[model samples]
Target chain A: MIRRFGSSQVSALLVGLVAVAAFAATYGFDPVPDGLPGLGAVEFPRLVCLLLAGMAVLLFLQESPPHDPETAPPIGRDAWMIFAACLAAVPLMATIGMLGTIAVFLVVAGRLWGETRWPLLVGVSLGMTAVIWLVFVKIFRLTLPGGWLFGG
Target chain B: MEAFLGGLAILLDPYVMLMVLLGTVLGIFVGALPGISGSTTIALLLPMTISMGPVPAICFLGAIYCAANFGGSITAIMVNAPGDPSASATALEGFKMAEKGQAGLALGMSAISSAIGGIVSIVVLIFAAPLLARAAYSFGPPEYFALALFGLSMCAAIGGDSALKNLMAAALGLLIATVGMDLTTGVERYAFGVMELSDGIGFVPVLIGLFAVGEMLDQATRRFGKPAIIALDAARVPGMAEMRKCWRSIWIGSGIGTFIGALPALGATTAALIGYNETKRWSKHQHEFGHGSIEGVAGPEAANNAAVGGSMVPTLALGIPGSATTAIILAGLIVQGVRPGPHLFTEQPTLLYAVFASMLAANIFYLVMGLTMAKFFARISLIPPAFLWPSVFALSLIGAYGPNQSMGDVWVMLAAGVVGLLFRRAGFSPAPLIMGLVLGGMVEETLKQSLLIFGDDLTGFLHRPIAMTLIVVTLAGLSWPLVARLLRGVRGARA
Candidate 1:
């Protein structure tokens, strides 16, 4: 029960901090231009921030019910690993080309999800990447990021 | 009548017909995949619309929007995986029917009822849009301000677990919307010296991040296990007896759906939930609810599909989106240089009527296609999440990067995906946030303009009857949850 309440409290605190940051950010905003009448840009955002802060307090005051352990599973290490691997592809795509990066990312993602058949993994990854490339890059004519490795 | 014929003529063109058919097929495929929403599909497809004519583009997107609503029920009924949040209510009784070897019956009921509901709502749209557009012409900034406030209040009321949390999420979204240069004063608000941030966050990238990548992240954490393989009995279309039994629920759901969908900020998810509850309450066989009731499947399925047509009314007439999918469609219209307002009805009657005709055609096509392909669509749920989600992730990346061809947008998508995952884990919903983001600019501009007109006397707004009434409605809506809780407590104490 305390753990559940703690989570709620943490979220409320985060919300409150965001509200404060929003209010604080208003200090940097230039004043409404001369001759412009009634309620500057800062006023509405400031009002929203105050309301947000008040709601954050109200949210904190409300007691959160205990979570059912059976239903709420703990985040596992593998999930974090997968998330990190996915995020890593962002930078990697800039190094390797789009098609190459996607091919590698899919194979790695499939492996992480417990698909161990190398032939199946390679075929699916390369096949899907090619199709997406052909459709999006070729047919749609939308520009995709071509990395330095591709000499674009 | 001439304008309607011109619209029909445009749709009769082979190219436009092909686009509509392709869009419907794509919509069904995407909607059958769990966690891939129709709005996300539209966001991904928005760039492709640039090459097409305005009529065919809007018509194609409209067909997808209409068909996707019905297609979501396919998986929801078969394997209990709701392809969209709006299909959750359908999944409750639908999976039960599947367990009882009546999957075909449930699917058939949903498909037929959806067609009925959609057709009814389309008829309403055809009649109501012109009237609504005329009324909308009289609306000034004050009225628009009040309308936006009411819409935002409804978002808090209908979304997430708690109203306070929803408000906070909306506030966050509003703050995010203020990131670029302030439109009013010609001064930058929160660009933080980044060149890319000057244009504000790209809408498509953020949408793809929130809906597609966020869902992928959530799916990654869960164990796939083995797919539930229910042996589908013969594809049994519901007979006239079954249809007759469900007609009342279908009509009631359609009515509720059409009314709610015409209201700003309330989407198909809320409509489906309310429709399910109302149908159960009025049902003669109420005990059959949650235990394979045909009415249960019909109610939500009909309501959700009906909402697709109903949502188009405000999008076309008032320049306000009634749902997220319509919001993206509105963006598509704006991109096509077709502003959605009263002028659209007057100036682009052919385009407007084409959209209406396409929706009608899509509804008829979906009924035929759905009945024929119900079993095949059901098999889609049997695919492992392991393989499916990775492809979704890949597609999300391409979608985020496609529009601007910018790595900056990709980074924004990644960051937004993280924020989305955190929001989900904390019991806060992204729906209200999305609503805030979509409405934020309109709210700010209208409020400023209203204030300029009123000249520091905020109470002067009370003189405007429509604006005042909407403000009052917003206040009541915001307070009703608290008032209901207090009344419940008092009743409990007295008892």
Candidate 2:
């Protein structure tokens, strides 16, 4: 039988409900018009809640198993490292033009993906970055961030 | 006809032609790259194109949208990585063909089918839009609400998983859409005093975050999976024999895509999915599916391309975006001081014609580029995930921030990425949410207007033939699956 109370569904339901309730508590007023036909924003959320509640009930009754742990795909080690590094890069991207950010990301990615040949990897990565950079800057005239180092 | 010829003349000018070709080539390259989608490509380019003549810019963006929609299939087939979600189904069969050393044939089939679907859709759009616009001229709010309801119901009915879930997602989307100021009452509903929330979350940021960043997170989880080693050789174009095999699928899929695209709120992804499902349902060898069936590739690729064309219909005829990308494109049009409603055809016939011409030209360019670049683009599949994910993630941020140059948008991307990941884990498809957001305002505004006109009597919908027709069709659409399931159950019981 499917486990409806799996952590994922429970979390989603909780977050979604909390979000709705927070909105209601903060901005909501009582006496939302009753017997309102399905028209306008006033009626829309009421219907939405009915639908969500019904879905929650359906989830409870379904026979699907919680995600099968045995068949679960591995969250690769390299992916985690890359994700962490990329998150670090988001704030820095404004200082570095897209090309610069791409260059660093490519080099890091190549290493993490286990490309032994650095020369080929770096060459292709930089080549693509340069092409995109030149196109955006020269042809399209869109100004990508000029990294602090590049001095525009 | 004279207007069409005049429009054609304007599109054929050397400058317009050059831009179309350039846009098509650029679109193909960008689309072939993983992590970049047609919407981002257009968003990045639209700002630059704004200063140019609007006709040329429309033509340029048109080419990009058309070619990019087709270009995504290249990565899908070669690397088993879909460059865009629309091409995900294509990868199912296209990647299998590559595994079987038929990468060239697969590429060729996709190119031809994409070209055919694109051309057919443009033709239909060119002819059908004017007629539809004429019909829409008589439509008031009730008609529009009925139309939007029909569209939303179609998504709920046809979504592959539970109808309840799709409705929930769409309902949630509609609710989220209402979180800003109420247009009628001029009072805030859910903004909670956040000024940014007052604008109600700009569409571009939300889209980039949900679709693009969410996609990256999903891809990141697969980082450790074994990469497929495609034996890269000169990719061959599919021979005429194979083309003939999938021609029927291409036609049916294109028709399906165009029809779905013509529907408000439905996008290329929906069309592609529906086409793929329908192809599998109708095929004699459904068992061969999920294992590199050529029909699988042809059907989805065709549908998506056609859907691109289909989406333009509402934008031009009714000022509504049929899909997210088109919605962005519509915003771009408005930024350029062009109105994209039915008035556009009468007011800006040359621009409309130019768009049509660019769409037609994009197909030709897509065919040419796909044939020549198949071998070269296939090499991208071999690029490792470490480098790929970071670069893609970075690009997603840049693309997300490009439209308005807002930092808030970047945060939106991050939040959307997290939310998207949560939704994915919870087995919720983001497609319905997208449909809901795109159509939500229209549903609200239209329903409000309809109620003002009809005064709480929904039976007023039956007074209008077109509205009544849509309502009937929506009911049929919702019930078809249930009826089919019931018949299947009866047969199983007898067995």
Candidate 3:
């Protein structure tokens, strides 16, 4: 028979492990000068890392509430698709620029989320892109990468 | 009085007043939308507010905070959906009122009670904040460190049902706060050779990712069904007789809301909940509660709106946030080069007073807006997730990128979004983490300073009367859950 751990238990253990690693890594921080020495710079992170590890242990040992549903979030295919599109915007903006990336991401995200009408998707995406450009670029005078392909 | 008058003078400026008006209108629409919260909206718009300069920016955000709580009751009354978590209690009787064809009465009363409660809390804030600031004048490093810890200790009770998870999230926040170069030692801790990380994680990107982008991802996963909504019964807006019946409930809610909101970790949601319960307990028409009692609609609406002003007190007076929105507002104030604390009363009277006056104006603005255009806002609650979430994402993208024009910030934002989702999956709240992140540096700095002052003696904390009192409270708070659990076990055995 195999014993299964719930997502909460697993997450707790993972965070605990990370806290331990974070504490160990703090050893690499630069030492405080001899003149001013109560708590060093690394002391604060170390304190928090230890607290995190302790809390993680407590969380791991804690029983799951019987009334509650499964601990894992209900991230279905569409949710992942939306996340992927958002992540892809970074590279797409680098390749095709901000406006182009917005349009592409919108169409892809819209389709994945079940917006079937091509004209509506394209029109809305275009409108969003135009609004973003006007507000971010024109009005606020903020910069988005013009893209190497767009020749700045 | 001088500061109050100066603030009114500033609020009278056309640009400042316009920002308040815009913020009130925008807050209502967003707050009436189920998924978009005031916190998310403020986060998405934070970077843009930079261009608006400090005064207008703060006023805009303040008005939004004030109006959003009242706006939430609009949807609760009409569609049985709470646009803000603070309005959940309102839905109990508010939806019943709607179903019984009394939505207009509920809507009108909610607005009226909300305005009254909000105005009452603002008056309290005007008198209370400076007094708190005066009290804080004698506080030293040790006292501040203990105070910050006391603030963090409340994390175990907030966010979600799981105390341990909330504490863990707060710890993660503290760790994140250590990312920047140490002010005293001038050594980078967590930057990992990234230049942007040396200044620490940007608050705007983290907030945008956590609230906006994170919520969008969550929204994409779930499907919601449209509930039967009641059309506005315009002819029967609450008359003076109804007001006579509800004055007691409204006052109870406002008092509870103001008290709860002023507490460090407590916020509008908690205030509204307690307000509902208390109003139910004290009402003359207790039998009418679940059957569309007008007092039921008025109580929580007033409480939640009142909580907006209540939450501002600690954020302004002590450099500690009272709620998530105020945390974001505190960040906005900091980015504008205004550090909020006891000194702000003396150093930035115009800014302080402006906040007070604008919040007062916002209550009036929303009262008028709610009474007149509630029908229009009621329809906006039905916005499809497809159109809404994507637009939010697009705006979030610009918001994260706009501040420093740094792509690194955008990447950080995306990462925070992922973390936010993971937090939800683990049944952790992002709120405690935010509070910790905001207060972490202060805790670390004050601790170090205290240590230096005490010649590295750990027992020095006991010598400071205020610090000692705060630490005692913090310890009691941290232990209460365990003690209560033990007591329950004993009682079970007795049974």
Say which candidate scores most in lDDT: 3
Chain B of candidate 3 achieves a TM-score of: 0.98
Q: Report the first chain's TM-score for all candidates.
A: 0.88, 0.66, 0.86
The positional error of residue A94 in candidate 2, measured at the CA in angstroms, is: 7.4
Better of 2 and 3 by TM-score: 3
- In CAPRI terms, model 2 is classed as acceptable
Candidate 1 vs candidate 2, DockQ winner: 1
The prediction achieving the highest DockQ against the true structure is 3
Stretches of candidate 1 above 4 Å error?
A: A1-5, A68-72, B489-495
Q: Give Cα-based local distance difference scores for all models.
A: 0.82, 0.74, 0.86
Q: Could you arrange the candidates by DockQ from highest to lowest? A: 3, 1, 2
Off by over 4 Å in 3: A1-3, A66-73, A149-151, B225-228, B233-236
lDDT per residue as tens, model 1, A2-105: 35465568788888998999899888887778987667768777888898899889889888646633323577877787798789989998888677788888
Q: Clashing residue pairs, candidate 3?
A: none
Please give me the DockQ of candidate 2 compared with the native complex: 0.32
| lDDT (C-alpha) at residue A85 in model 3 | 91
Clashes of each: 0, 6, 0
Best by TM-score: 3
